[model samples]
Target: MSVNARRLAAATLATGVIAGLVGLACIHLLHWIQALAWDMHGGTLLEAASAVSPTRRILVLTLGGVIGALSWFLLFRRNKAITSVSAAVSGTPMPPLRATWHALTQVLIVGLGASVGREVAPREMAAAFSAAAADRLGLSAEDRRIIVACGAGAGLAAVYSIPLSGAVYTLEILLVSRSGRAVAPAFLTSGIAVLISTGFTRPAPFYTVPTLTPSLSLTVFGALVGPLLGAAGWAFKQAVARVGAARPRDWRLLLTLPAAFLVVGLIASRLPSVLGNGQASAQTQFDATWAAGAGLAFAALVLAAKTLTTFLTIRAGGWGGVLTPAVALGAGLGAVIGLPWAAAWPGSEVAAFAFIGAAAFLGASMNAPFTGLILVIEFTAQGPTILVPAVLAVGGATAATTWLTRHAR
Candidate 1:
């Protein structure tokens, strides 16, 4: 190999290595921060709420959101933002300082009640730091791309402890139309990050489900729910678009924050399970009394409210990811449909439907079926009995959303 080729290889190796370490570090820092924040907030908020109302802890959720958003606005909103992971795929560089604040805002969003996951925050920060490093070192566009991809994969792998999914996400989503040359560096970083993340947390998959088979009646019934989910996805897209457009109207938009919080708080007081990520509730739905007496209309309303409030929060400049909140909503809706099936068919695959609901909702909302599917599988690691249903719903959801936008500019 030529001297220049050798130097480039060495540089790529070094960048990937540093990016990998930073990625590992970033996830741990975020987790440490989250553990303290969630615990303190959860406990204090629960205590405070219990003092007056014997009802469950719903105020804690809204209070956390208020605190997070207020801090972001008062402290961090003035900075010039950096290119996020999604933007860096085109080889653009972003400043780490900016990504850092965005990361903080994202954590705040989730810590409060914005209805999303926290992974997007630090992942973007790591990508920005890696991209900034590449720019400072005067790397080529190809190198910059690989560096950014490595950084993103590292963040995800570290956060989730799933290197294969992280690597696949970088390849399938980040490098959607790119060359295979980007693979080696990204894979290396992701592997390193996964090791670090798994070391910190249990390596077990996110959830465990009991073995359940879908009877013929339940299978057919779930298949029928596919169209309704598609419709919900379309409605969610419209709500997001509407809220995005509302941002330019005025600062009056921020009013929706407290208003939406009030409503969500009311809902959570009555239906506390809808407050946070739904993985726990989804797992326990077999015995949750809240799942009972809830009809399709109730599920539809909660789904709509959660989707709208989430969009409103972001539109009002609250930062967060859309994955978990959407999943929680989807799970609620799916349980509404699945509970009835379970009532009739004792061996029904209710959890499977809940899982599929999550994957399909995420696929439609994000327009990334592979990310949705892989995340669903890796997050749960349940058997193919569940995976098969999720894949089917994801494919259908993706096709429907893509078809609807076939003529869009």
Candidate 2:
């Protein structure tokens, strides 16, 4: 190679090493902070909130929504200078300090009761840190992109403890337009970050899952379910989009925030148990043995609520992605249907089907089907048993979403 080519190679190698270390520190530190935020603060708030009168619970939820909304409205509207993480990921993406601050502040909204999670804000922070650092180190555009990808992947791996899935998610979600490039540097960095963060993590399997094998007939049947789930995923996307576009105050801070608190409080207050991230409840539904009508009803309303919450925040101009709520919502859907399918289908457990539902909708809804599959595997540790239903449910969801949006940009 020529002299310049040799220097470029050397620089890339050096940058990758530095990123591995930086990504490690950033990922672990953030994970610890986030864990504390959710576990200590969020958990405390939830328990306390649950004890209050129904009216108090609604007020709490609404306040959370207001904070979340106020956060977006203030930051996004004021800082014309800052660029968003989504924009950065696509063509020449960069995460400057402005974006970083914006991301950091948004955490309160979720942590306090915004009916959302921390993944949306922190993931962006990781991506911004990686991309910005790569650029500072004089990496090429292509190289920087690769480094950013790794930083994000590493961040995700560190956060979720599924380093492999994180590595894959970094590549899969960012490759929305279907680019064939791989971010090897990012993968390497993310892997290193996971190792460093592992020391700080508590011992607990993210999700406990049984080993499973698919019968040929069940495998084929799952393939058929994909499209239906895809359609469901598409509907969810549309619901959020609609609420995002609804009239002012309908979902906005001045009006929507109160409205949101009212709705959330009303439902959660009455149910007394369906509130918060609802992950526990969603998991229960996934056990595949819940009553059909009850499960189905809860899932339907949650799907609606999740879609509305996401829309009001993003479209009404809240600052976060719809991913986590989508995950919970999707899991609920799977649980609801999984129970019935288990009872009615030839031979299958609700857990298995619920697992598939979560993966399929998560993948299809975000246009990152592979990430969905990997996340489910990482989240539940279901392994190859997850593959068949994943193919059926996720594949179908992707195809349907693609078809539904074919005419749109």
Candidate 3:
């Protein structure tokens, strides 16, 4: 290789390693906080939450709100706002120190049982770190952008052990590039990060899923329900965007943030499923057996609570992602709809329906159909046959969301 090419390759390797380490640190920090707050040494967030007293839940989250508000205020007041991962990839500078602090604060709040996804923290940190490293290496702007995007994907890959999905996230969502140059580095960085993370994290899939055999009923369900759920997902995405656009940034956060988190705590004291990212609730839905009437009502309630809390958090100036929250929303949709379908379709599995809904909803919400599809499959490590229904669902979802987005503009 030429000197420049060799230097670029070395830098890419370094970015991947840095991404992996950042992922680990964010995760470890989150878990540590969870343990400290809820005494959650083992078991899921829901279990830990359930064991805690309602007063404790309310107190901890309220305290988190106060701390988060103060920290965010200081961070933003002291520095120019850190650009998002997409903005960074598009040539906006991401000040590394500001970005790192932003990412770490995100992890901290989420660990305190804030109702937001933690995935963005690692991705943002990885991007910031990569941009800094690339600048120090004196790489070209194009190389820096690619490395930053790949580093983000690598961070996601390391955190979830979903390498292919991470690469797809980069190409499909961030860089919007699938050329040979982009493709190779995206996959290389993600794969390397996942391998490195395996040393500290489990190699098992992110969720616990039962054996799901594809059925004709599921195929039919996917074809029929996908578009409806797609529209729902689009609505959710729009809500988040609308609230985010209006989110507090000034002294108002001191009041709004604590009020929002207090509301979440009040609800979580009753539901417990609404706390933290949507993972625990999603897992609960996956493992649940949805019956008729009551099951549908409960699922609907949980979905509503989860959606409201997530929106509230964002609107209150809490920074996070909706990826996992969207999954939980979809799972709830599946359960609510699938209960009736089960009564009619005889052999339909609600869990399988929930899984399909999750994929479809994620695709629509993110407008990244392939990444959503791959993430679901990777998270469950399900059989290839399951993809048949998932693909149909994602296709329908993509079409519906695309139409809605175009019309809304």
Candidate 4:
């Protein structure tokens, strides 16, 4: 390697290592906070909610929102323009302290049972730290952006244990680049972060899928369901955007934050599955048995409740991501659609159908079908037999979403 090449490699390696360590520390801290606040062991917020009473669930969520609002007021009162990791990777200057506070507040709110995903915190913090490191190392602007993007991907890979998807997410979503230079650092950073995280956290797939056999009938069913999910995903994105566009104010925060928590609590009182980021609930839908009528009804309720509650949480000044909630919503919708079919088809896996919904929903929402497909595959530890249907679903959903948005415009 040439002298400049060697220096780049060294900088990349250092960035990866730093990102990995930061990811590990943040994850551990999240777990500790969860244990202290909820008095539960290890699990996602929904799983932890299962162990607590309905009243406690309500209290925790309300308290969390209040805390989150106050934290936002104190930390980000002056600078309310939160820069995303993607924006940072595109040459926007990142404020390290502000980003760190943002991530920390997210972790705290999610841990306290806010209806949002915890993944954003680690990614934001990782990007901020990596950007700072790159600046100190005197790297070129382009190299710094790539490292920051890689670091964001590393944080995601560490948290979810999906290295390949993380790398793809960095290249496709964060950097919007497919060059070799982009691929190398992203893959290296994600791999390193996952490696380090495995030492501290157990290595396990996020979701378990039952064995499924490929069939023509399944493919057709997936194709049909994809567009429906696409419409849903598009609706969800619109809801979030509509809610997010409103300016944040103290009165709005005080009223909406608690109200959002109240709604979550009310929903949790009957359907605890709608709580948290929805992962535990999605897992339960995959594993548990329900009567066709009752199951479908419950699934629909959760689909609506989760969607509204997540929207409320974000609109109320709570910090978190929607990907997990989207996955959960997709799983529920898929289960509702697939249960009847599974009854007719003796060997069909409802969970597998739910998995396809997940990929499709995420793909349509993000406009990155490959990332969604790979993420679901990695998260579920499914085999290649599901890929054809997953791809079909994602493609259908993306097309439907794009067409709808275009026409609406």
- Which candidate number would show the highest TM-score if scored against the true structure? 3
- Model 3 backbone overlap count: 0
* Model 4, runs deviating above 4 Å: 2-4, 42-47, 200-202, 247-251, 291-293, 344-347
Order by TM-score, highest first: 3, 4, 1, 2
TM-score of each: 0.79, 0.78, 0.96, 0.93
Report the lDDT tens digits of candidate 2 across residue range 203-232.
354544566557553565468777877777
Q: What's each prediction's clash count?
A: 2, 8, 0, 0
Question: Candidate 1 at residue 190, lDDT?
Answer: 74
| Deviation (Å) of 13 in candidate 2 | 8.9
Task: Mark the regions of model 1 whose C-alpha exceeds 4 Å error after superposition.
Answer: 1-66, 74-82, 200-202, 212-224, 248-263, 277-305, 341-347, 407-409
TM-score quality measure for candidate 1: 0.79
- Enumerate residue pairs that collide in model 3: none
Between candidates 3 and 4, the one scoring higher on lDDT is 3
lDDT of 3 by residue, 52-87 (tens): 899999998998899899888888675535588999
List model 4 lDDT by residue over 1-409, tens digit each.
8655665576678767876777787778877877876776855555667778888878877788788877877765566688888899887888888888889888887777778888888899889888888877777878888899998988888877788988999988888898887789999988888888775354767876677667766688788889988888788778777877663645467667777787777777667776666676677666636644467776666677777778778877776878788788777777778778777774557777788788888777777778878887888788488777777888889889989999998
Best by lDDT: 3
Alpha-carbon lDDT, every model:
0.60, 0.58, 0.86, 0.78
